[model samples]
Target: MSSSIISDATSKVKNMVAGEKGRKVADLDSVSQTVSPDDRITSDFGVKMGNVDEWLRVANEKKTGPMLLEDSFSRERIHRFDHERIPERVVHARGAGAFGNFRLFESIEDLTTAGVLTDTSRETPVFVRFSTVQGSRGSADTVRDVRGFAVKFYTQEGNWDIVGNNIPVFFIQDSIKFPDIIHAVKPEPHNEVPQAQSAHNNFWDFVFMHTEATHMFMWTMSDRAIPRSYRMMQGFGVNTFVLVNQKGERHFVKFHWTPELGVHSFVWDEALKLAGQDPDFHRKDLYEAIDNGAFPKWKFGIQVIPESKEHDFEFDILDATKIWPEDLVPVRYIGELELNKNVDEYFPQTEQVAFCTSHMVPGIAHSDDPLLQGRSFSYFDTQLSRLGINWQELPINKPVCPVMNFNRDGQGRHTITKGQVNYWPNRFEARPPATAQEGAYPEPPFNIQGIKARTKSDKFREHYNQAQLFFNSLSEPEKNHLAAAFSFELDHCEDPIVYERMSQRLADIDLGLAQTVAEMVGGTKPEKQTRANHGKKASKISQVEFAPAKPTIASRRIAIIIADGFDNTAYSTVKATIKAASALPFTIGPRRSEVFPAGASKKPGNGVQPDHHLEGMRSTMFDAIFVPGGAESIKTLAKSGRALHWLREAFGHLKAIGGTGEAVELFKLAFALPDLRVSATDEAIESYGVVTLSKVSPESLRESITIAKEGVGFLEKFLYQISQHKNFDRELAGLNSQVAY
Candidate 1:
């Protein structure tokens, strides 16, 4: 052969070796590429192409003929577009995710040997996905459904996934009934009605039959179902797991993630309105908060029971439908989780990420919890069908630590191990498994001797105790909301039997609750309780107890409504005060165009430009509303029915409302409640979360924004009310129902 031919053959062989060995990749950023105008369009195989707009065809200069099958570029483009989507998760189909870090504030070395929980010096990287359980990918975010809170911790040892939900308990005790509960709550099979809702006949009937679902169903019907934002909700690892220490001791553990901002939820009417006004409300809220540098943080806690004391609980610790009362087993907060980064791309980062209950690092092992066991199996199997056998190799799912194994050759396989041997204990001792001493997972020895049977423990049968406890623990406003939720859901059940049976089932928890819902839904009102109420209450079960130690208005959305002639001084000062407190302030005007102040010209660009117009966004999208004073501005707002409705709706929803000077008269006119009070002088007065000041000055408007229980100034009082989240006192006093929006 010639010398040139031999050189070409040698180059080809070197390229093949490089391909099998695989190029070294340092991190996720190294593999990521940014699209720019400077880069040329190319095929998947990296061939630059021309004339992408037209297909290869046999035609004259002006007329085009049938496209040719030999057009590789067109064929490749069409093929890629056809298979762009993978099957979404059977549950948690709609979700939003972010990247963050988990830091151990207090080492819990005695409880477990896991480094993420024991090493206070280390910051473990994490990815958290917040989702709705029953919704499809296109469903609205504000629907009344259980929220999925799954966190994947990419620790040094391996990836540990805490597959959990906003509510600690699940709908069923055992995993065998998982399909039944999901099917019942999902859109009905016959006509597929009621998408992403439990207010249906089949769901009510299923809960009535399965008594174990009583506790979880009560939680679903509470305000917890409609969270205001993903950042404001608590997350719980519902299934029980085992934590083993260096001393070879085991303890039953339940995980908890409490938000730093405290738990808050939208009123039913507000939630319902936002579902139609903005289906991506929650998703946008999360992304915007992170983008604005108001990173959401959560306290990591664990409720632990010693191996010998596991059987001491009144309810089975392994049951998925029950919660260990905090009064009995207190939570020990040891770490903190803060999400600081948003994903670069939705498809590659958020959508492709997969979590498994079976993914646990060393020192953490699965308990014999029946529901958890089946979940561990089901999650892995489901990923196979959706992402194929080599799902773990995906960048979003791959572990940070080295992965050396004999397993190879599957669809979408990216790793190319350069080796002749692919088996363990081979002549070369290739890819041998690590022992427990070599940072491997250790299995604790425990005695297990039982006959194979399909039965739960006797304690699991006692379901009404905790359900009653949860109801009794709630505040009066919370109780009313829960009852109202029950009424609304049952009313949606067209079948008489489903609603009637469910109404009677409520008597098992509380007679008054059963009777209240029964009357509203037209069911037979129960005069007596079916089962005597234990009247037991537990701490931390009610969301009111989750309030933060210090009040904060950070990241809250406050809308400032104004017209053409508004008080520029008060508006500008209040907006600055809100921003200084780290809260978001938006201007809502009659038009998106510039609106003039009291003295400014009404010409183009001479006044302030509103962020959004009145009809463009509703009061439901904000945490509070404020209207600055100006006689002309107040007169304009007073004459417009939509503007009056905005104030009334905010009042009915129990949100904080504020006004200064002439705007105070607008509030009085809009509310029109004889019982409602407004400020008559320069001093600020807050009644039922309606803070108003009859007069305004630069000094008065510039008062320090302190969030005290009883704020002394106009700005302070208004900020304090915003921090409180909602004015439940108005609802309890029956004032909220008196106004018409």
Candidate 2:
């Protein structure tokens, strides 16, 4: 596994940047491949490292742990490549981006003077990027990883970037060790294995060694890392930031984005399959939903800790890895945000959209978290290096409001700044005037202490309590997902040492969690946990608790499969009924259009339009499948393996499958089903995703329509069930003969 992963990791770099850098840079196991994957392997100067593995292996054995003078290729490559790549951000590097906007509801005059949140009418454009911290850009989205949920609000005042993630806490206390944690989590340099993931030896070794990552690892292994949709996941500003009110009173605040639809995640099985089926799944879903008019929304909330009580909590407010239980610090919802737009161009809008922790408006500012301070300096500098010093001038990074400043001129300066004088004290009063009022732009008056030295806060030492809290809070299935996630990641580790170390760390958080993981990972579990005060628990942290009290099929898709010589009216009614319920229905048949001839002439289609033909659609693509009544069509469909295969796939996916008319005969013939739940009338596919419609009322699309409109019985029962994502537990029944497509 290590060897294969190492080769794969090397190949990724080959794919990303061979041509752009002029030389073929090989030592890089980086994720961003600028060049094509299939492009010929080349060196920094376009030379090939033919049979690289054998060569390196042979040389290493020859040296026997020491560098030999004769191996110039290995020496030169590792040496130069050591300085080839710059440092990745302290957090949130492996992320995907999209363009959107945030419209305000009501002004929050009581909280802060931040223009973006205070203005009720302005529609500030934004580019939101969601990411995984431990993985590279090439990693799977399903990996149990912290999702970076950073949004840059191009407000009228300036750009206010709320850099956050799905998980509330972070891995470390201070910025001093930020580099160390990142280095440990990133692909190890010795062999440079493990592309786009943290289930490796070096990373686990670091976790066990440092012990600060306990809280974060718990989050990493949980289901939150494998979100069903970007729209459904919550976002949090990990650190404690400050929000100053109009009166100039400073309040230490934390930000939250509770999705209006509530939080949901993909089952681990589904997430893994999706990674292979479509690595671009989440990205595609977000884009398609935005395109199809299903705009995602979230309510903005803040938890303010008074300046006087900053030191009152048992745990430090500034610790990135610690979370203040909502029970203690209630989330006061301030405003709302809606992402109604898609990017015009991915490269210009999504790719160039830079989110810096330091991008703050006058009212909002950073805290004392060492990591955040490093971020303030890192982001702009990294952008300068990556997109040039004038990257802020780029359209996506540019502030919505006009930018006026004396600072000008740098590499890649696209705009030609006019005027002879760039200084503020110019004799010409033609320059933009500054507001004199303290409310206009006053900095919070806070005193600084001590000499400039590297020191961490004492509160940073408590890491396991929140980890325990998070683990203790999960529902049964959610906890199972976490254990499964740990197993999945660690199972990929080739080194037993790595697995052992990781297991010890896991044991520190939760012994059962560690034992379960180690059993699967082929390592010994620690007898006990090795952490300080194991802290409190909360019910609300787990997303399962947030399942909408009432389930609605608003955005769900149901497919009504049909064929020629079938009771067309029954199929049409069911289709129409689902539509009436405000759920989407697709008319699927043997072909794109299933024709119904009148009387004896009813043969092939005179002409019929299907929402999607069987070929264009699949059971995996929809929430449920229904077979309309038609004796002739039913026999034809039964004979054709495609029809049975369609239902089988739907069943395998745990989607609702219902039949009416001769369609009931097809179900009876479907003896090749496992754990079949033939509802007395209607059955909800528990493993799959919907309410199957059978016993169609041709005379009345009304009964089904009644069932549809009311979110009761099978509909609501399986609503949350289907939303659970992939049925990893499914054990399929065998086919006597393989069903043909």
Question: How high is the lDDT of residue 554 in model 1?
Answer: 92
Tens digits of per-residue lDDT for model 2, 1-741:
466765654464344334333422121112234567777665567777664443243344346453456655666677877855444444565556766668777676676788787887777777798777766556666655678898998765667898888988777766667778888877788877765677777777777777778888778778788787787899998878888787777778999999876787765655666676566767776776676666777888888898778899888888888888889999888677777766655655566668788988878877887768887887777787667778887766766454556778787676665555677554443343457362346676788877876666788787677778888888776787788788888887788878877877777677788788888888886777665435567867888677554444555567777777777666666566565555567778777644662233644545456777776655655666777666777887888776777777655544455565567668756543454444445433332232334554434233353332234444343334443433333322323123222
Give the range of the ten consecutive residues with the poorest summed lDDT in model 2: 23-32
Each prediction's Cα lDDT score?
Answer: 0.91, 0.68
RMSD of 1: 4.6
lDDT of 1 by residue, 408-495 (tens): 8989998887756677675544445778887888877889998898897888899899899999999999999999999999999999
Task: After superposing candidate 2 on the true structure, give the runs of residues whose Cα lies further than 4 Å from its correct spot.
Answer: 1-99, 132-144, 187-193, 430-433, 436-440, 450-453, 525-535, 557-570, 577-677, 681-694, 703-741
Q: What TM-score does candidate 1 reach?
A: 0.96
lDDT of model 2, residue 34? 54
Q: What shift in Å separates residue 503 of candidate 2 from its native position after superposition? A: 2.7
Cα displacement (Å) at residue 24, model 2: 46
Highest lDDT against the true fold, candidate: 1
Highest-scoring model, TM-score:
1
